[model samples]
Target: MPVSPLLVVTRLLRCLSIGLLLPCVPTGALAQQLASPRDTSFTVHSAYVKAKKQHPDISIARPPVPRGVRAQTKLTYCTPGSRALQLDVFYPKAKRRQQFPAVLLIHGGGWRSGDRSQHVPLAQQLAGRGFVAVTAEYRLSTEAPYPAAVQDLKAAIRWMRANARTYAIDTTRVAVWGFSAGGQLAALIGSTNGNSLFEAGSCHRPHSSAVQAIVDVDGILAFLHPESGEGNDSKSTSAATYWFGSNKLTRPDLWQQASALSYVGAGTPPMLFINSGVDRMHAGRDDMMRQLTALGIYTEVHSFPEAPHPFPLFNPWFQPTLEYTVNFLNKVFPRR
Candidate 1:
């Protein structure tokens, strides 16, 4: 019996997400090896079903889109030659004359899986609450590696600013929100506001990629910090190792550079950290808060004790997570 290339890639992604490492494959060669039908198994529904094993009462059902909020899906935000990155937007239908603060939401699946639709419910709720919320898609580790996803996000931000009128977005109060791996990305992107290393492509180059605020949900701040649990590739390849294209020991420089804590300093914007009971999930958060506090940059944190890492997508903690996020965003980007 012969194995299908798509099945092989899907299994590889699942292994990587679970911290099992595989041999490094060159990007060009891997691109040529893969066939049609990309894997899309990771989603809020799947996560909820798995989480229900521990929390039997949790729910994944999202509320109805509130009245006056509009949703537009499958909007192309960027074209990186090989692929078209799409995003889903949710914003108020009325009050086109007034520009509202916007937030770009990024989902997480160990950087190997997950897609924009995982955060669509949250975006819809945010829109109902008077925000221009967007859920964006980026190249996963299976498709591309580090800096590629980051670049895609920065491009998405620029796209928002470039089409501010179409979405009724207030460019000055734009924010980036991420869950898990996405949270790590949000922090890094926010920390490196004008740094050119992560900023690439010419899409909406005139519009800045800098975000006014960052919301990190259970995402690590430092990859190689003493408190960090990532890059344990002694026996198996960790997801971080696969995404970075090198183990922490082999490429310490890249790991450190990718850490948000490395660049968080004077210019970093205000931030909010939402976490589950898993301390290892948010490595270096305390150190980051201390630095932000010293710099007089507003910082807030909320932890769901004993909750799973994907608490935001499940009930019992979902409402509170949404509340904290809304409060933090409103406080940082006050409504005019």
Candidate 2:
């Protein structure tokens, strides 16, 4: 073998050349990376930009905002003893207008990890359509506990109101919006509607977190902690247990009580819920919507026939969502 060193080196060089000529990554693995959040956003942004270029009405060059529009990242509220509270605010450009209506967006991550920044594209999309969109971050269960997130939401609402003039927002017309876990909280805010008991026991000053309307996209409505019931979903996690430490099966009374459906009485806000018509996600959207409807509340339901769970903010119907949201604002916002 020592006598064939030159031949062995020649063979190794040939193998190295062949390897370099092959693709850097396997085909499937590279595709998954492209679909990841980072790549997906870049792709979607390019698409949005190209589409806007083709149709300029959808976008306008407004300074004071980012390259596309006016956005400010600031701490809206923070945990009592921790430096945790923050929010991203997106609004129209200077030449646009003053005191526009706002949408407060909360993200979903099983109440353990999602942040408002993930929804920046949606915020920008909303801002592009003349709405002041805010994506807020609240304490998660690991960092805090139940009502901590709710309290943060309430604080955000109050902050929006108290600093309305400064932020150029019209507090009279605010909407709470969320996807999945966030959707549940949005429903809770809509259902509870200024309840004093829910607002108590938080370091945050007691303030109303209620909204004129609520849009919950695939959110669980009940807190069925220790979740049980012959019909309860076994394949998925329940909002009651994840956010509150129990499920409906073990806490039947509490489940029925905390379920957003239970609180839909007279004077509840108009609500829009979009979900697939099954357990793919949003386990009991139908039941919640039905219960709310029975209470004489204005409810609109749109189920994507075959869409998968948690449709990204880049789906085709994204524009339709925008249209419907704007319509809701037109009917609810206050006059100058």
Candidate 3:
């Protein structure tokens, strides 16, 4: 028997609803649409809010150790309060007597959540590539705000330098790489090397917090820029507001002070920026790049097409991101 016209139309509609009729639509298109970088900052903020509601005591599991890498956990880097700030260090088994370069890996969580354990895989990957990798925990906005996180990161750098010999790290070749909010701190540390204001109080005194190179992965460069999408309006509370405890209207000076752009100058370290092409979170990136170029500082930028802000944390993009990072570090801090 011949099929009725109405029945044929209904079958087509059902196939279309399930996407079976749309052969041209790429596989994983829905996931790509959901993970688009266009509004990733807000997406991340929402996730944090939801996680806080659902699981107040959420714990991050440490990643499994990779082959030929050594893991050291919970080493105290600073004692800011009753709580001690600790870091996890990873390094490769030395093939020879040569010292390895070091990298301080910073995790991203909108400056409110997340911990050092989030970066364990990246740290292990770097360690496997013959670098001493340290992932350090910093105070979140929930505990302390604004410069507290920055100071803690700088302290980590100093602490690492002070104990460089113990890990067989080449002191002169130290670098920092931060993801998301950590990217902002990494840029801040690189820009404010000689500035005493950001130097955390006496954690590892007399040791320089200067880094020879910096790698920023989807980090905001200027928090107040119009393109930042941070809503600078008086009543609007941005992630920056949460970090600073005040809106731009109320604390314009502090907003400007905390910006990485504010610290850019002649001596800024060579930097490599890995960005998400569709991500607007790292607004004003071009402006900073121009300034770096004009000042004759070495800088490079690589954007992943249609990827999310945290693309580097996952596979397919992860390998390429790691390659770009290692290559940039090698070029900036070449083995002598």
Q: Give TM-scores for every candidate, taking all chains together and pairing residue i with residue i.
A: 0.90, 0.70, 0.79
Q: Is candidate 1 or candidate 2 better by lDDT?
A: 1
State the lDDT of candidate 3 residue by residue for 1-336, as single tens digits: 444557556765665444232232222433233222322342334544554553454322234566889988999999886559999999987756679999999988878776776678788888988899999999876556678899999899999999887788888888999988888888888888878898767689789898889898988888778778664544544567667765566567777887788877888889999987645667767888899999999999998866656666654567778889999998888886
Error of 1 at 207 (Å): 0.9
User: How much does candidate 1 score in TM-score?
Assistant: 0.90
| Candidate 1 local lDDT, 150-236, one digit each (tens) | 999999999999999898899999999999999999999999999999988878899999999999999999998888899887787
Worst 10 residues of 2 by lDDT: 19-28
RMSD of 3: 16.7
Specify the highest-lDDT model's number: 1
Could you arrange the candidates by TM-score from highest to lowest? 1, 3, 2
- Give every collision pair in model 1: 21-237
Residue 24's lDDT in candidate 3: 21
Strongest candidate by TM-score: 1
